[model samples]
Target: MRTDPTQPRLRPARRGRFAPSPTGDLHPGSLLAAFGSWLLARHDGAEWWVRVEDLDPPREQPGAIERQLRTLEAFGLVSDGPILRQSSRDTAYREALDRLLGSGAAFECWCSRSDLAATGGLHHACVSGPQAGRAPAVRLRIPCGESVAFDDAIQGRVAQDVGTEVGDVVLRRADGFWAYQLAVVVDDAAQAITDVVRGADLLDSTPRQILLQRALGLPTPSYAHLPLIVDAQGRKLSKSTDAVPIDDANPLPALRFAWRALGQDPAALESCTDLAGTLAAAREAFSPACIPSESVALHNTGVAIAS
Candidate 1:
């Protein structure tokens, strides 16, 4: 007994996610990122999941997550699966840390602020100090002369040597919270993400992520880094930057703006009166390769920048 030879090979479903920190409301730049990710996933007939990156409690605003998700919904960017919150996934992260520690892929760093600045901060375990009763930060050991490279969807071929450019990166902070680099890598693997589409500002972090993936025996996904959205002064928009929140009362304007900013044609979408119809049209007409250029500035648009 054998399977039919003419049967097509079954491919696993592609998974893409939009993980935003709950530090602020949805700005135009973040909206653009979400829009691009949504279009790509929907166009591919893939799963689009949303993850709340609420790792740092101190930095998170009280109600920013709810506002952000509501804003995304008003723009017709609904997620496919139940939302995931990083704050609730501490057990998984701890297990991953234990595995890394057992495998010697991670080490406790005792480097002080002054030592890191003085020693170029590229090597791990360089300043092993008093570990009497303090919890030292955990750092990944980047092998020397290691080159991490990947072909990006938008930015073309990108490569970096983590050992040379960036030394051992912290996985856990002294404050006992998991570092973003470690948490993101672990969660991406756990979620079985197939592609990562996000702002180009995080392009530099890819190499480190790839390194972690390999070390942790996790799968590395394809990446697409969109151009950073800058303001009139060429400043990138973020919680720390000057970016206006998208008003939910009139979401059409901001939605159209984000669509155009992602390099999507707005000729027909502009006529749409409803958010769902607009998103449907954009998704049907989307082509990942057609998103021309990288950066978009919203200096005079009375909106935020593009990313």
Candidate 2:
């Protein structure tokens, strides 16, 4: 199960995906990521797919996934295949974990969150113990002193000391649900995802996922982390932060604004008569270099309050 760094298997290149958790309505931030990912796939002439990461039942809001899908359709962002729901892939994840366990690349740890919190989140508590089957979470046993590095399409040549920056991270949670790092890595490999475009909020977690990719013997996908939209106070806009969701009732204005937020100068509001035209103009003018690398606060004007 140990990922041979020198000989990591390179899968045949294919398309990309946008995997979003259905915890809330699609907000402006999420829309930015979706649009960016969609455009990237289109630019490469690759099939774009969508996956609903609904593994955490407690955090998933009822009906949120359907609402998000409708919103994406409203925004004119379509995917190629039937939407893949993570909840339906439990058997696949379980088999991957079993393989890792059998190969000794993964180990069961009974350490609770509280236990790890006390030791700064990276301390190994169960390196050696009786193979107890107490409701333990599975953790990828990271080899100490190994560095995981990847050349991010946007960030460029990023690296992290996996042993210290991220400890033996969890594959399965104490609640028996699979952790995002584990599921995302496995799914991306399984789906043959070539590129991953997401918001900058996940920039810090990229190195961890790279380590997981190394551990799981999977091919790593190219990544482009888009700039995050922040509030006036510099906080990332999220449901818990009370950030407003994208209004599907009138999406043109919001789409226009999102294009601007990503550093595109669209035609004036009066120029484009409809949403489709505005987005078409955007796709033609979309350039990754135009978007800012850092988070910025967008004024809630035409897009946020469009009738």
Candidate 3:
């Protein structure tokens, strides 16, 4: 399905998403990821979607979802479709889980974190079958030596043996909350996402997601993992660190910094007077070739690694 050399690469029907979990204000690292996905989708003439991953009621702040979207909107990175929230999509996730469960590809797991730790999480001993008395967690039964490999848009060849390296992935926690891996996999398929442009931190998780997609007979979207923004201490910048929020009222400095951090020549945008101009110039200049394979440190962002 290669594009013709004489034609544009974008399709009007092509879709991308900047799915975020609402936990706090937008910071530099989070903004960088959002801007990256937004810029790429717009550059290719694709429809970009915003999905709020608000599945975890306990961790999510009361008003953080609206605030996060407002921040992206303030920075001119708006979604093309009606915003989708995971909280409203439980039926979809459950259906997908049911498919796997009925296929015998998923099973009830009763192993606690401590139980898994004691048995070496990657081994067969860690996978406890359904127990009558205990609350059960749903986990995918990965075939042994399930070696999956894919070429990343930016990071290049990535390969993972999920069965050995990651063990069985939890689809639903004992608390009954849909697991991040399963929810994200189901949501991406539901949205018809053509590409996934996000931080490098989630690169390792892609194989697990791909396994789920295959088990459920869903299409796997192309992936591009941007370098992560870290701090002076080399720790990934995140909400847990209380990352400083970016100022949406004055976004130029942060945009410029993000542009450079993504390996683009920011000097070309010197003539652009405003945020729109900067964005316009970026649409022309955005190249996966320019983005680096490794993660780089950015000062702050009030969120954790998102994909």
Candidate 4:
């Protein structure tokens, strides 16, 4: 099967996702993430998927997942694929953990938070020996001087030495729950996600995910971390009481606000009156170059501070 040199190679279609935890309602900050991700996907003529990160049941609110999805729908940010819920994907995570453990890239960790407190909350070795009745957490064994580096589509070149800066990160908790680091890596690879566009708060976690992808022999997706939307006090919208939930009944204001927060010109959406029209205009006017690399603050009225 000889190939012709004149033919251009075909790149895999871009697949992007917006995975949200069901900890709370769809707030302005989250809307910014969803809108940014959806806009980028649409602008690239790619598929956009939604995933519910319902792994932490204790932290998740009842019916929050449904409400969040509904809000996205109301804002015309619909998923192109069937929704994926992390709660139903434990088997996949377990298999990924098993592979890492078998390859010696991961190990059973018996150290508690208190046990590693002296090491500034980083786990290098088990401080507390195995307890008789305690369950052990699983962690990746970050090799000495191991460094992960990648060119973020938006944030530019980013690098991190997991061994020094992060140390060993947990895969499965002692409480018998799968850690987010493992589940997210597995899910993204499973979904063949080519580009990850999310909030800048997750920028630091990108290297860890890339490390996991290497350990599992999976392809690392391109990353584009959008600036996070914080409250007036400079707290991330998710963690702040000032975070306002998007009112799906009247999506225009929030839609326009999110559009502006993405560094896109709000004038692109000013002519729109409905969700579909606003999204379409936004997609047409979206410029990856316009997106800010720094987090922006939002007032309770959905206004950007010097934005």
Per-model C-alpha lDDT, please?
Answer: 0.83, 0.79, 0.83, 0.88
What tens-digit string does per-residue lDDT give for candidate 1 at 1-307? Answer: 7899899979998999999999989888898899888888888778999999999999999999999999888777888888999999999999999999999999887777777776675664566685777778888988767788899989999989888788788899988998889899999988889989899989999999899889999999989887667876777877336688878877778877877777767685767888678777887778787775567777544433322
Give the clash count for each candidate: 2, 0, 2, 0
RMSD of 3: 4.6
Q: After superposition, how far is residue 263 of candidate 2 from its true place, in Å?
A: 1.4
In the range 1-307, model 3's lDDT, one tens digit per residue, is 7768998666447799898888777877788799888877887777899999887899888889888988898788989888999999989999999999999999887888777785466544445667777788888998779889999988899999988888889999998899989999998988899899988889999999999999999999999898888777787778337377778677777787777778888676668879789888888888767887767765432223321
State the lDDT of candidate 4 residue by residue for 67-99, as single tens digits: 999999988889999999999998999899999
Alpha-carbon RMSD of each model = 2.4, 5.5, 4.6, 2.3
Of models 1 and 4, which has the larger lDDT?
4
> Which candidate gets the maximum TM-score versus the true structure?
4
List the candidates' TM-scores in order.
Answer: 0.93, 0.89, 0.90, 0.96
Residue pairs in steric clash, candidate 4? none
Candidate 2 regions with alpha-carbon error over 4 angstroms:
1-13, 127-134, 239-242, 268-270, 300-305
Judge candidate 4 against the unseen true structure and give its global Cα lDDT, from 0 to 1: 0.88
Scored against the true structure, residue 211 in model 2 reaches a CA lDDT of 73
Worst 10 residues of 1 by lDDT: 298-307
